[model samples]
Target: MKLSEGVEAAIHCAALLAGLAPGKTLPAAALADYHGVSASYLVKHLNRLVAAGMLASVPGPHGGYRLGRPATRISLLDIVLAVEGPEPAFRCGEIRQRGPGALEPEAYRKPCGINVAMLRAEQAWRGALRAARLADVIAGYEAEADPRALAFGCAFLERHQRPGSPLSNPE
Candidate 1:
């Protein structure tokens, strides 16, 4: 199934947040710049993440955004849901009940086989996403990404990470 572009941006933003020092945060504009997306577009997704409790939005001059919880606790499914909502990619309209030679309403009481299969596949896909934590993604990135890519990410975080107060709650 095709997911929205926002999902990619949201996942990348989460991974970047995982790299920040404890209590550090990054502004939306900086995140957009790093991801090569518009700040307005990124903010919409960021707001959704905050609403989903996947991200924490801090206020004030030294404030920005940070993880709502540990990276280990946040799954890719969480990010996907935050950006794309919880609806499955496929929806069955029960076309079997429509058109010519359609059976009586009670005759087609059994769920559509095609719908059942699609839902089953969607469940499997969601299960895989649910099993994948943001921490795992970051670990894999650090381990498998190109050296220059790693260096650039590190440099960007070093340069743009805002210093949130030690006592401030990320939420």
Candidate 2:
């Protein structure tokens, strides 16, 4: 199924936060700039992550955003649900009983093959996404990113991170 842009943004933003020093944070604008997303729109997704316990917002002069927990604990499904919500992407309307050639109870009481197939596909999709986590994505990225650049990026965030920022209760 096609996912929204927020899903990509939220995942990337979370991965970026994962690379930061523990307790360090980055402003929404910085995240937006890094991913070339609208700041306000990114904030909306960021808020979802915070509300979902995937990230946290620290308020104050040095206030910004940081991951609420380790990347390994955050799944892609968590980010997907946080932004797009957990509703099934496909909704069955029972159209079999509504068409001009509608079938009788015996034929209609049972689900159509198409519907059953779709449901199974949906279940499989959910299972795959559920098994995928932010840590998995980061591992792939880490494999490709230059170690020195990654180190520099982490150092930059730590050096520039604001002090006394509120820490998120990630439980």
Candidate 3:
């Protein structure tokens, strides 16, 4: 199943916030600028995340958006479901019942192996995504990501991390 570009943007935006100092936040404009995307459209995905309880919208001068909980508690599946809804990628319309040669017997109404296989594959994909948390992905990347990219992420966050932010690890 093809996911919207917003899925990619929202995932990255969530990851960025995952590293922010606790209570510190980044606005939709900041996230859009980081990815060179349009703020108006990107905020659409952001609002979805907020509604899903994956993000919280803060108000006022010190207000912006922040993770609603720890990164470890937020799975990739959650973000995907938030943006794409809880619909299954594979939709079975029971075409076998509509064709002229369709099976017709009290014992012939079972799902075919092909349909079962497709359903299994979709389940496995969802399982893998659900098992993946942003913290896990970030930790994996930190181990092997390019030095320049790592530096850029750290520096970008450093510039944004607020003093007394709870997200930062106390030195």
- The lDDT of each candidate is 0.90, 0.83, 0.81
Native-vs-model 2 lDDT?
Answer: 0.83
Where is model 3 more than 4 Å wrong at Cα? 103-108, 160-171
Each candidate's TM vs. the true structure? 0.95, 0.86, 0.85
lDDT of 1 by residue, 3-114 (tens): 9999999999989988888888899999999999999999999999999988888888878898888898999999999899988899998888899979889999888999
Give the per-residue lDDT digits (tens) of candidate 2, residues 96-155: 778789877677766777778888997888888889988899889788989997787676
Could you tell me how far off, in angstroms, the CA of residue 21 lies in candidate 1 after the best superposition?
Answer: 0.9
Better lDDT candidate (1, 3): 1
Stretches of candidate 2 exceeding 4 Å from the true structure: 104-107, 146-160, 164-171
lDDT of 3 by residue, 51-168 (tens): 9888877766656677877788889999999999998888887776667787665545677676788889989999999999988988988899999998998788777654433443
Candidate structures ordered by lDDT, highest first: 1, 2, 3
Q: Point to the candidate with the largest lDDT.
A: 1
After superposition, the stretches of candidate 1 with alpha carbons farther than 4 Å from their true spots are: 168-171
lDDT of 3 at 113: 71
